[model samples]
Target: MIQEKRSKRGALLGLAASILVLVLVIVLENTLAPTSQLFVVLKKGAVYSLVAVSMNLVNGFTGLFSLGQAGFMLLGAYTYAILTVPVSAKDTVYYLFGGSAVKFSLPDLFGGVDTPTGLILGVLLAIILGGCVAAFFAWLIGLPVLRLKSDYLAIATLGFAEIIRAIFQWQALGPITNGANMITQIPTFNNFNITDESGKVVFRLSAFFPMLIMIICVALIVMLINSSYGRAFKAIREDEIAAEAMGINLAKHKMLSFVISSFFSGVGGALFAMFANNAQAKVYTSTMTYEILLIVVIGGIGSISGSVLSTFLYVACSEWWLRGLDMGSFLGIKLGLFRNGFRMVVFSVVIMIVVLFFRQGIMGNKEITDLLKPRKKTKEVAK
Candidate 1:
């Protein structure tokens, strides 16, 4: 009973702390300009974090090493970009075609209200549709690929992602996908900020919107991981033979996880497109999948908090904070090695060092609660 009380208190404290941080972020959003570089990195981190968490769901939790994330993201990005673009802007944006084949925006369902509410609803619906489309693709691909195991599965998924990129780039699909060109004018999260009569800005609709979505998605993953189905997935990950002996339907659980992961990845892709302010087939590349996988591993496979923490770190290194290393001069010295892509080299080395030395990553297969708890949850469960 004492332990249970402590657990309850810990949970309550965690919840209160989470709410406080969220409130602080909102306060900053209203005070800070949406275009602030810090917010830019934060927003970018939110999108990548969402994608990484989705990837972690299948790769980390399910023991699936699938590499089809880029493909699903590409599909989702294209779907959202195409569907959310204004009908009036389509013709101009798609100069290659007379206009976009779809010729409508989901937000126009309200007959183009032009209000903040209308924009929000429209973009949200488009993102949902994009995720559905990506899920559909996953359903098709998972049928055969999920049957494969180990590295073979990775190769197959990677191949399929390339196939998707190629298809999107094909000239025949140019009318809808804009071919090799980037699609622009789709409503973005930044477009959702609210302001007062004095134009002082009242609310940041999307400043916190993407992160909220990511948090909600990550929470659902936590719920699933704590459920009976999640246990079965872990069992399968441990030993397929033993899992089969236990009478768990391996194929069914794998398929379910794959589909769910793909859905969120698609949603993440839509968010990515919005964050980028444009979508292009070339943007969603194999490197992206590798980066996300690297992030999952660095955060510790099956560790959500690790993924979240590593995301900010990864974004800071790749996009902002570590950019100083990539320049021709650093700390008042000019170096030949510190030119252009040198930051990535240093970043890669750091990742290699972590993997070589730390091994279990920043958090292993452990949740943050495991640390907060007086005892390991898994040990308690086993007992």
Candidate 2:
């Protein structure tokens, strides 16, 4: 009963905190200019947070070192872009290929593209479709690759990603994939902003939209992590042979983790496309996977909150906070050594320092709520 009370209190505290954060985001969006640097950081951070957490689900929780996140994301992005692009813009977007093979757009089919309800339903459907596509591919790939252990699994998945990228860019598939070209004109987060008839902005929700999605997705992942299946995953991660000995289905849990991770990664990819206002196969490269891997590691492998915190920090440092380092001047100090790609160099060094010193990472498989708990003070009586 006491433990249950503590859990209930924690739940209430967490809910209160989440509501406060959402309120804060709404207030900031309305109070500040739409172009504020904070918005950029928040929007991108939210998207990356989802992907990072998805990757963490497999790598940290299930002990699967799959490196095909970019491939799944590419699938998701293309699925979303191909399905959401306005039919009128099809000729232009796929002009090089003569026209998109797909005739209908999701938004158009729902209730016409202009209706608010239709737009919401259409985008939601498209995102889910993207995830389903990714999960399907993950299942197909997992059949053989999941049998491999450790680095071999990683190599096979990485190869799969490269192959998928190549396939998506093949000229013969241009009608569907756009063949090395970008798919644009899809509805983006900016569309969520409320505007007057004359196009004057009334409320900005570009950041809030992604934040809301990220929170919901992350919450689902958290609940899964706290479930029986999640425990089975952790058991497999700790000792596969031992897990199997304990009556756990290694193959089943592993496949479930892989598919779920890919599903969310695909959703993240769709969100990424919305954030960028375009989707291109070339952009979802091995480098992207490595960047997300770095986030997972730097955040601590098994911690959901760690991934969220680290993603925001990583994005902000690379995109905004350390940007001056690339301009050859920071804090009024100008130096030739700081020019161009110097920011990344400094960022890389900082990452190394964190890794070497902290080792287990910022949270080390612990969530933010772990810190929220008060420690009991012990009294020492000396004679």
Candidate 3:
């Protein structure tokens, strides 16, 4: 009873703290000097956090080692880009296709290109459609692919992603996908900007829009993980044969988890495209999926908080914040030893140290609250 009360209090505190942090970020993003590089990293990190959680839902919670996140992301990014790109911009964006096969734009269909409200709805719809398309593809792939176990499953999923990439790049699909060319001018989070009459910044759109989207995605995953179905997933993860013997339908549950994961990965991809200012099939490579998997591993499988935390760390250290490693200066001194790609070299070394020393990862399959408890009591609970 006492432990339960402590846990509840901890959760409440965490919630309050998260809200405070959200508000603080909003204020900083809008009122402070135009969105800083740090804010850019944070926004990107939020998107990554969402994808990592989705990946965790399958690979960590469900004990599926699927490696098709990049494929799903490609679907989402392309769907979003193709739909949200301005009709006026399509011919130019799809110059390679002579004229895009998709002559009608989603924004125009919804009155979005001409009006603010429609623009908002259309952008939101594009994001939703992106997820739906990815989920549909996941369903198709999951039908046969989900039957495989372990490494075979991983290979099959990875291959499916490659096939999807190839299809998107094919000439026959050139009209819709632009045939290996990048889809640009898609409505980004920046499109929702609210500015002053004098063009002075008021509420920054880019940071908050994507942040809100990511939060919603993360919330959905949490709800799913805590639901009764989550228990079935956990059971399957522990022992699939045992779970099946106990009346669980392994196929149904696996398919559901896979579809859900793919949906969010697609959404994340769309946000990533917006951040990157373009979507190209080449950008959604296997190497990118491996990076997300590395985050899940570093964060502790089955630990959502771990995934979220590690995402910020990974993005900050590896991409944006650690640029100093490549620069000549360090602190107050000029370091001549540091050179190009040093950030990645340092990132790899750090990952190796984490893998070797922190066997269970940063959070180690535990919630953030678990860290708040007495170490002895937490260890007791783990045992």
TM-score on alpha carbons, each prediction:
0.91, 0.95, 0.92
What would the per-residue lDDT of candidate 3 be over residues 64-96, giving only the tens digit for each residue? 999999999999999998888887888898888
- Evaluated at residue 270, the lDDT of candidate 2 is 92
Off by more than 4 A, model 3 = 1-15, 196-200, 373-383
Model 2 agreement with the true structure over 1-383: per-residue lDDT tens digits: 97567656655555666666677889999998887788888889998999999999999999999999999999999999999999999999999999999999999898755678768899989998999999999999999999999999999999999999999989899998889999999999998888888888899887888888888888788878878999999999999999999999999999999999999999999999999999999999999999999898899999888898899989988888888899879989998899899998887887888778887898899777666655632121000
lDDT score, candidate 3: 0.84
Task: After the best TM-score superposition of candidate 1, give how far the Cα of residue 181 lies from its true spot, in angstroms.
Answer: 1.0
How many backbone overlaps does candidate 2 show? 0
Specify the highest-TM-score model's number.
2
Name the weakest run of 10 consecutive residues (lDDT summed) in model 1: 374-383
**What ranges in model 2 sit over 4 Å off?**
1-7, 374-383
User: Which pairs of residues collide in model 2?
Assistant: none
Give candidate 2's error at residue 63 in angstroms: 0.9
